[model samples]
Target chain A: MVLIGINEFIYVASILFLIGLLGVLLRRNTIVIFMSIELMLNAINLALVAFSRFNNSMDGSIFVFFIMTVAAAEVALGLAIIVMLYRQRQTILVNELKQLNG
Target chain B: MIDILFSIFASLVLLSALAVVLNRNAVNSAMFMIVSLVATAGLFILLEAYFLAILQILVYAGAVMVLFLFIIMLLDVDKGENFNFKTRKLSLCATILGVLLLLALILNSFSSNNLPSVELFLIEDSSFIDPGAFDNKAKAFGQLLFTKYMLPFQVIGFLLLVAMIGVIVISKKPKF
Candidate 1:
């Protein structure tokens, strides 16, 4: 009998967030790290939606709408940057992306 | 019934989230992320946020994820053979940190729901809404967004315009 509560949702959000953090830290590839960042943002979205439910307000829901918009913009820009990086460096690994130091 | 729906979707979200991290291939990770996002939208529906649930499916699972797949295939980015790692220390640390964070969140959730924000919203709403009236949530949010949040909304539009220009300018190939 899995009794789901608001706390269950919170716990799920926290675990997903930690997974995102580890993914960012452990993965060396820039694409993988970028995916991890998206995962973290999704976790935030989950928490916001859950809080909006319990708090009985439209504010958090509206906030999530804006967050979604910002996320779309971020993906567009980030993918462009990734494409440019690959063209310039011939690789997408984060460990090898220090061309700015020159 | 709701609890069952939540459990199923939540499990799907967790499994796909783990897959996004553990998969060696970036393409596979992106695919898994789409699954995770879809399940997240399902959870939003359970929470009765209909508009957000639909937006999550449309924007995140549809548009954004397709963009991810496009970039991945276009870039031809793949992981190399140097993939193995010493999981002993890192996994242990991550497990400990995760457990601690979950514990803190669980404890906080179990306590009373007397949060200031909750209280404030209750006062503003002034009465318990009928379950049939949940659709009104979207209406209220739309109204507030257009009125009180209008300025920020306009700013975000401008920000998106700027970001578009910046990306094109930055990614443009410089001629020698």
Candidate 2:
């Protein structure tokens, strides 16, 4: 008598992903956008775990472990880049960073 | 009982996530992000991924967020700017696109019936890889990592090493 359905989890994940997408699109700060990307990754992880549990497999959990590792590495690198940029430009606003557009 | 817990955690995740996005202050956003992450960890517990739940808290909520806070404080961008883009057109387009995607998801979800219904008790009682076999969940994961997942584990280690060197190089002041 499971009160919850797989589709419900899927829906929650999708909505969370959408919220992250909206955050990425709407936010002006670089750090906030970075957080939005993390949120997106979290949403995908939720979906993966849900499917893994429903399907009775440990593969999805393994993939999640890998994703978390990659995400940690990505955060370290991305923050370093942000720090470097701030050292030079003294600001982290996304709109002000248009030197590469030309 | 589980349904209530799931709903509570789900709503907590959603609200905190929204707060993370909507908060004007970076520090506030970071704090809210932590809340959102911990709530997601709660969802992981509901999913019976005790190992992942701990990792989610330790990695995402603990380590990664502390880094974010350190950077935020280091840079001192305490005052947040306007939430929306300066250009009205761009903001409108983004909002419209997000709305459309949400609509599509909802429509498809209602229209589809292919997802199989599963019994929670059966999943909990039997199908999950014999929890007692390895005597410990962490041990089970370790065995899998050392055996079936050996290559990827090594690759991840290498990737972490590369990332470490790359960070040092990127952050170091040039010595010209």
Candidate 3:
């Protein structure tokens, strides 16, 4: 019964992470990939909070705070870049942005 | 009880994440991503980190995802054909790598001695029955952020400010 604790959360996080990884690997849309990355971050946050609760330590929660801050920052920058790319190419397809491949 | 709830949310999160990736329309992907984020936040609540779970909903699902959707809406990306990898070999390699990583993670988890164990903190003189009501987690978090992690916190704030400025500069039309 007690086994339904932190390990369960870890399993959930791992599944989310795997899904995100597959999204990043298989998706061609830049926006979708970015969303997957956000998913990955959320998965990590779940693990952090779960461990924090199980260990009775506040540090993991604190880490989640910082992670959220960084994730917000990342979203801002990432969207800005995506917007710029869309302006230049008129499409958000990851495969279409091969101008830098030279 | 907890396991059942956890499994349900986990499946929902994973499914939404897959939909986000597989959906052809960028806006639809963003919407599914929002769903996934919300489900992840629910899982966080189940983990007893109520403060974090609320923050997750507020920040990621609410603020960040909205920002993403706004950008997608503003961009008006054409419904182009989905991009497929040029070489099947590359995708095959990626799949193999993914499977190997998954296998390793499961094996490592089983082999580790750090299996999950709950530690009960001794709460003296606190008669609060609702853990959510007595939750000083956010307060304690703020204190630590301001004291020990203050510099890093300020750095991140400054970085966000810079990013905002950069976006403005980039998006502005030339006056000339």
For model 1, state the Cα shift of residue B159 in Å: 1.2
| Candidate no. 2 TM-score | 0.93
Candidate 2 at residue A76, lDDT? 100
Interface RMSD of 1: 4.3
- By DockQ, who's the top model here? 2
Question: Tens digits of per-residue lDDT for model 2 on A1-102?
Answer: 568877878888888898898889888899989999999999999998888777766678888899999999999999999999999998888888899999
- Backbone clash count for every predicted candidate, in the order shown: 0, 0, 0
Model 1 steric clash pairs: none
TM-score of chain A of each: 0.91, 0.97, 0.94
Candidate 1 lDDT over A19-53, as tens digits, reads 89888767777777888898898999999877777
The order by descending TM-score is 2, 3, 1
Order the numbered candidates by DockQ, best leading: 2, 3, 1
lDDT preference between candidates 1 and 3, better one: 1
Q: After aligning candidate 2 to the native by TM-score, how far in Å is the CA of B54 from where it should be?
A: 0.5
lDDT string, candidate 3, A1-102, tens digits:
433666667877887787788778877777778888988888898888777767656677888888898889788888888887777778888777788899
TM-score of each: 0.84, 0.93, 0.87
lDDT of each: 0.78, 0.85, 0.76
* TM-score values for chain B across all models: 0.77, 0.87, 0.80
- lDDT (Cα) of model 3: 0.76
